[model samples]
Target: MQEARYTLDDLLTLMQVLRDPQQGCPWDVAQHWDSIVPHTIEEAHEVADAIERRAFDELPGELGDLLFQIVYYAQFGREEGRFDFHDIVHVLTAKMITRHPHVFPDGHLGSRRQGVAAVDVDTSAVGQRWEARKVNERDSRAATSHLDDIPLALPALSRASKLSSRASRAGFDWPDHRGALDKIREELAELEVEIEAGHQENMNAELGDLLFAVVNLARHLEVDPEQALRGTGQRFERRFRHVEDAVRESGHPIEHTDLDTLECHWQEAKRIERGQ
Candidate 1:
């Protein structure tokens, strides 16, 4: 006997069956667009986490979970007579072909053969052209602002970075990284003042300002602030776990550990991590 092989159509069929009124899985059939939003977000984060951890073997499963989220939405849309998976696929395919002028014949950059043969096309120029095309698309939708299309559901750091980038494109940004760094310092000073005044509401606002400034600095430095912060969190967890293990080995309860003792273990953990 041979194992069954399935194609994308098979996957679509499976999704349809799972959402069938009579024979469907109750959980799958009961899910609506809003109900599945959290699962979609979690699946996306899992995909990112797998990539960040360099777990290539786990990537396919994570990607499949993310893809299933799209399929779930597509299924729900079909039931409402809005759109289906094919519509989603078609839009993405068309968008890619339209955006990559250097590769596709219909793109603004002309065909790849003609453009590459004629002269070098810098990646930066390609990126700028892509953004320009997206802006045009937004304009076609009657968008009144450069930030209009940015999703509100994006992580705070990522959204801040994108907002700053859009504003910069609109000529409303700092001239350089130095200016962004200076803004961060100014924001931090304001935060300190708010803290000293013991005004919780003002402190909260000032803290947000400081974080936004830091995100802007990250954008100016061409760093992805979300990824940078995620990496920092992972490192902190690893080091903290090492400190905990050391305390356990020394027969000291973590609750009984003094600040100096914890600091000693933290330094040792850092040294071990650095192979020093």
Candidate 2:
């Protein structure tokens, strides 16, 4: 007989066994949601990188890793008698169906372009709608009332970027990208003042404001600031490697080269990489 291929249900059942107090794997039983969090974040970034590289085949494996993290959390929940893997899937699936009204609602079928018009109204109006829906959902769940549920545990850059974007969409943003640029300049000036006054906290706050403004400008230009930063990182790595190669070809380590000379090699690297 062929060994049975594991199904999703098998995964769920395995989770239960892992959480079983009497015979469960000690390591798995000892894990908590907080302990597994870093793995989940790492898996998500790996999935993003794989997708960016167009490695479709690698996506399934990376996604499986992420799913395993989720299952691990669900197992922990089950051990605490709070919820199980099934509830996790059911809540997310239902949320997806709810958010995609055009797909889920009866007698509604059209191109995504058709939905864009409704979504492009005044930003505050859209925010109001989302907030209202969120409050209603919270009320149904546990009678919570507030629009400040955004998690504070997200990476600083990501959290700032998202908060800025949401504020922009709420119509409390710069009038245009040019306006955002001015705000960036203003923040830079304030940072200088803080520096002159030796005010570390004020300088830090101003620097953050500058970065937030830049993120806003990136959004207005339809660019992802994080992805833009990553692309520049790749470019810098390639150019720096070229400098290292040139230095090695001349029989010296890169550290031995003078700054100006190495910079020339850096430009050469850029030119060659750009096919210029």
lDDT by residue for model 2 (149-218), tens:
5568776666767777656655787777899889889888998999999999988888888898888888
Segments of candidate 2 deviating more than 4 angstroms: 1-4, 107-147, 196-199
In the predicted model 1, the residue pairs found to clash are: none
Clashing pairs in 2: none
TM-score of each: 0.94, 0.81
lDDT of 1 by residue, 67-134 (tens): 99999999988999999999998889888889886777655434454526525768888899899999
User: What stretches of model 1 exceed 4 Å from their correct place?
Assistant: 107-120
In lDDT terms, which candidate is top? 1
Best candidate per TM-score, number?
1
Q: Specify the poorest-scoring 10-residue window by lDDT in model 2.
A: 106-115
Q: How many residue pairs clash in each candidate?
A: 0, 0
State in Å the error of residue 23, model 2. 2.8
Cα error, residue 72 of model 1, in Å, equals 1.0
The CA lDDT of each predicted structure is 0.91, 0.79
